[model samples]
Target: MLKPEIKVLDVQGQYRIHTEFYRSDTAENTIILVNGSMATTASFAQTVKNLHPHLNVVLYDQPYAGKSKPHNQHQKMLTKELEAQMLLELIEHFSANYLMSFSWGGTAALTALACTPRRIEKAVISSFSPLINGPMRDYLERGRRCLADCNRTQVGNLVNDTLGKHLPSLFKRFNFKHVSSLAEHEYAQMHFHIEQVLTCDQPCLLDTASGIEIPVLFINGAWDEYTSASDAQHFVQSIENSQFVRLENTGHFLDMEHKSASHISKAAMLGFLQPAHAEHLAASR
Candidate 1:
């Protein structure tokens, strides 16, 4: 079982943000897992649990997800600045140096890191795209339209529809004790979050990404409906020192359904993160 310990972080206005920490103190490179919108860090439970015992791992819920406190109604997260601030808060709170981000989170996580270069050591993106351009772009637009119209039922229905249509089996995999028990605000927040994702300023970050000299890893599902291998190739070609991995027979959700996103894959990452000696071991084998 994944080692999960509840942790609390104090942020602005004395607000408390809570998350599940998968602790490892004997590690060298510490990894911070960030979930995509409408999801929590619980999604990574199976992946990080079987990682190299020498690497530290942490999975934290964003401000609006899981036990993390939502931002103040007056002080919102519309702009990249607010999102960057939240990223800084989490990094400072945990003193984490590496990031493992998922889908739309790739954009937000990149925004956060680019805004504060001093915070992150390196980053890995699973089923991620720094730019939104195609169907996901259209879907997000539709979602924001629904949010602006205050269509909470539509919002709820859309989430259920997407899961049923694209990931029926995955929906069954998550026996969300709390997510299933969510009330109106939870549902509304989902709508608002979709809207936020579609509208957040991200081009600046994408432009700045070309200059980030960190070891960025892009992991994509071979069958992903959102992003394909070309996207990964383009991302790596554009960003300095970026690497791309295409996992077989998986879709938009990598960390959830892809074997490469599981604990087994974490072992691969462990080997890659090691020094030149381990790289030699991997090559010789």
Candidate 2:
């Protein structure tokens, strides 16, 4: 296993982001793996292990998650624009060639792509859509309310009830226990993240996505209620050079899904990000 070199980057003096870089000696490409809401750099540990031998991989904790705390603790809320800026800074610092993002992280990735498509060669975005579905909205609302009330236990239950339920039996128990054990500040950060998603401007984001010209592979789970396959397809249609893949029996958490579903999702991502495929796509562009 290749160990990551850890560092903290100052994002234009506005925020400090904690990042992990796994530099591959033989690979020519570097990809940034952006975490979804409530996820930290640790969430992509397995993914880094899977990709580092083939491509340089970068992972970071977004503001208010993991070791990346908000610069202004009083202003814990994060906006898509701010997140996009952070990603842009990372891209410049690392000279990244590709991007792979999950869920809400796709929002920032898309926003950054819209602003500067030339900087990134290709992208793989999983489980994201500009349009928020009714069920997803209710789920976020419920979590927000739970956080507002400072009910950490119920908040844990909410996660277990939704995403956790899709996990295998043993993993389900572990997920519940892990979520229940999160610190108070972590809960607050999660609350702010949920708030950001609930209040984000979808139409504006949709408009931003339409301008992205880079080849993209958008992946979603057929069983994911939070980001439905139809909605994901609609979002992919806006991007001129994009393909959509729907993993059967998977949910919002692709990496953490059951064995078969998780394996398929991982294979799809790895296959699309292979250097040969990326070069072919780039040439076609």
Candidate 3:
């Protein structure tokens, strides 16, 4: 039931990133949490509360997403590299040692961690593909069309349908009763990111695998509709010192379960970090 201290960070001396920092006395190491494209720090509320007892957790809104939207006044469009640089600065500022990310944030995390492996000792990345796979490409296309038509009904339907498809068994876990709660500016930002995802062809992580010198743990649902389990395997195989764990009876939202403290996702993360820390301590001895 612990809460994070809110702060506005000036990353890379350019962008102002809004972040939440949670401190824990029983902490093993600091973990930087990167949320999915559509998510804010609130998306990781339960997970953070569960982890705050044992780990120092930091959550942030990426540029043009959530609370950081107003800080993105630069003329240059948001790109993976730009996001990576901002993340690196944030990590340095916060003195965090571990990186944990979901979905699009995974891409940015991978890129940033690859470039600064010495700074980030370990990573737990979930549902992130190095490339835009076929299914994801199709999903982006649908988003592109939805943005082009500028229809609220179409947008709501598209998002709900996509959610239903990805989270058939767990759709009720989310609060989608107020899709209308999304503000106009937020909608435009979503459209812009979708366009970038569709148009940008640059590989975010796989190409820079050689630069990642730290241990990595990749987590994904066995039935993730947006990304295949094979892609998670590909990431593990591509990155050295990387491991993959596929959760059963789940979809893309691994942390979406509306549980209190003992969710599988939270356990898996704590398990990985604890053992990794033990190994680090042993090596130091």
Q: Note the residue pairs that clash in candidate 2.
A: none
Using all chains and alpha carbons, the TM-scores for the candidates as numbered come to: 0.78, 0.88, 0.84
- Decoy 1 TM-score against native: 0.78
Off by over 4 Å in 2: 70-76, 181-189, 200-202, 275-285
lDDT of 1: 0.62
lDDT per residue (tens digit) for residues 37-141 in model 2 = 767787776677667667889898875767776533536556677888889999989989899998878888998898864569889999887777898888888
Using lDDT as the measure, name the better of candidate 2 and candidate 3.
2
lDDT of 2: 0.79
Sorted by TM-score (best first), the order is: 2, 3, 1
- Model 1: weakest 10-residue lDDT segment is 71-80
List all candidate RMSDs to the true structure: 4.0, 4.0, 4.4
The residue pairs that clash in candidate 1, if any, are none
Candidate 3 has what TM-score? 0.84
Each model's backbone clash number: 0, 0, 0
